[model samples]
Target chain A: MSDTKTKKKRKEKPPIEEPLLAPGHRACSGCGESLGAKLVMDAAGPNTYATCCTGCLEVFSTPYPESAWKMPWIHSLFENSSAVAAGIEAALIAQGRDKDVNIIAMGGDGGTADIGIGCLSGMLERGHNILYVCFDNEAYMNTGVQRSGLTPFDARTSTSPPGKRSWGNKTTKKNLPGIAGAHGIPYVATATVGYPNDLINKVKKALKIQGPKYMQVHVPCPLGWIHPTDQTIEIAKLAVLTGLIPIYEMEYGEVTRVRKIGKNRRPVEDYLKPQGRFRHLFAKGAEAEEELEKIRQIAEDNIKKFGLA
Target chain B: MARPRPAGYVAEPGSSKANKTGSWRTEKPVFLHDTCTDCRICVLVCPDGIIFGADSIYDADFDFCKGCGICAAECPVDDIEMAPEVR
Candidate 1:
């Protein structure tokens, strides 16, 4: 028997995969948001303290006292999670208790990118030792799927309801990575729920670093997106394949790495057709192709601008 | 009131984009003189139409560069690096 064989033989069944986020919470079936939360918690470990903003995640996952989180958790306002996390982090520093525990501030894209953009910016510039994670479902899911700062242009959210007059969200989604990078934070990364390993690895890496880190992850909302429960991962992967979303990393406001655009670039329709929000795109003379192309240009600009070919 | 960084070591851009309106470039690449064997890994990897010719053009076109650090990460010689994007 070789030494390598003995080491390989000792690797036992991967410990049965314990459920970090226990069942019985109010998340919908095959909820990518919950899956994202689970992945973050798993990477954050038991001693992590999470400060969540109000949204579908905070509302559904931790209703009242029945929180699915097994660790310390706090929920501030719908848009002030980042500020609260900063305050809590300050408290931790005052108590001389900065080691071992990880401080994570989480919220949906609506909370982080739209309503809380100011707070998020302030926190990043202050250089607080924390990890800010935005579970981007692309729109304001909790407020009946309204247009948000992260909402893709031309997506039929309730507020940006698609019609002959309006083309969903008229303005382009704000680039949070560019904004955060501008703050010169130590780390900033874009990830998605479709790649759990990459998401976990980035989280672990952020924990080891000394300064604040930002991770924006794409999560598909089956209920709000009007998507099939099972297509959560499928849709997420499609967003990356097409030019809808580009995954990359930024250090001190400079792009460090960019995941190459997949060779087989699926038509943007492939990503849009599956969701209900984009149903208007199929209407007569929709002209969604032209609008979707603009979205593609945005992704391309990031790729070219950041060299994420 | 904050004492700014000395001009030598580049710092990340300390700025915001919400107020920023145009197609302004972010991310700037710098040279790591020691590790850089002058290998054009950065020049080759740059998807943006920046970086100079192999005859040692030593050019980094900020206008088109967009500050994507493909050059920095792909630099096997570690000669290329990304400076903090200070506005």
Candidate 2:
């Protein structure tokens, strides 16, 4: 056989056989959340049941008479997806089908970091055999871009607009992975749409482990972040490369792996400049520079904390 | 095609495959077969799941592809390019 043919023969097969998440749903063009969700679903394979909270994913995937999900999927209230998934797990166990099926609970940052946190905590504490995936778009994008707990500092959302007395959202993004790790879950991972391979691998690995697993995926929103739709992956990549969002996995309350930034590590400005939500911090003056310094320091802190250097 | 009954009602699982979302695209991805490595990353990463084919060959179903260049971006070989739609 030729070299190319031999290489093809030696290549490992892709996990997904048929598309589990079908097309024709209403997700916006270049939606990082939808893309990341599909990657996760594909990696988890067909023998999975997903529970989605009332957010962009649920809205787009199930628009009456239409559903993108081919497998068993449930849409629950904004704050009860994890609880619903726990119920599903209980039922599966009752029927002795727990080993054959995987349970997944998914939600946006608004649902995961804020509204749904209480139920999420219960699900984690109960140690259900479920994987909870939070698509962190940083704001409540479905509801006119209101500020959510995951909204980063100095971001301009509808509820956190900049003014003379206010500098956008006056708080840092919540460390959800850290919170999940504190729950003593067997697996906790932070991923982004920028790295599909890493995201897929982590999802696959998480599914193999028993008990609760939490994954926080950074998904950029073009409408909320005010970036061109085409730059979705670019912005996501910059977010990780700049060390603003450290990609890592924790097992049993200890970080076991960190996706390094490598030689192409960039400054925080490179990640912040593309998104218009951070535009106010880029004005040609001293105040803007000061705020920029603070944001840069956050990235520096992440680098040091995760040992990304 | 009948109108949807109400908010709580659902048709069939994966019925969204009937909704053609191609018109939403302002740009479309064109696969460069020459530079393609057949890694299937585009097929794997496409949000719409419109890209198909196995091994070293692939094609897209433009009827549902919303032109989310996620495929183009994730293509390791830089084999997919996004082009502005003529319309």
Every model's TM-score on chain B? 0.57, 0.81
Give stretches of model 2 more than 4 Å off. A1-18, B1-10, B73-78
Interface RMSD of each: 22.3, 2.9
lDDT of 1 by residue, A117-194 (tens): 889988998889989999999888876888889988778888888876887878877888888888999999999876
Listed in order, the DockQ scores are 0.01, 0.50
* Lowest-sum lDDT 10-residue window in model 1 chain A: A9-18
Q: What is the lDDT of candidate 1?
A: 0.72
CA-RMSD of model 1: 19.2
The prediction achieving the highest TM-score against the true structure is 2
User: What stretches of model 1 exceed 4 Å from their correct place?
Assistant: A1-10, B1-87
What are the per-candidate TM-scores when only chain A is compared? Answer: 0.92, 0.95
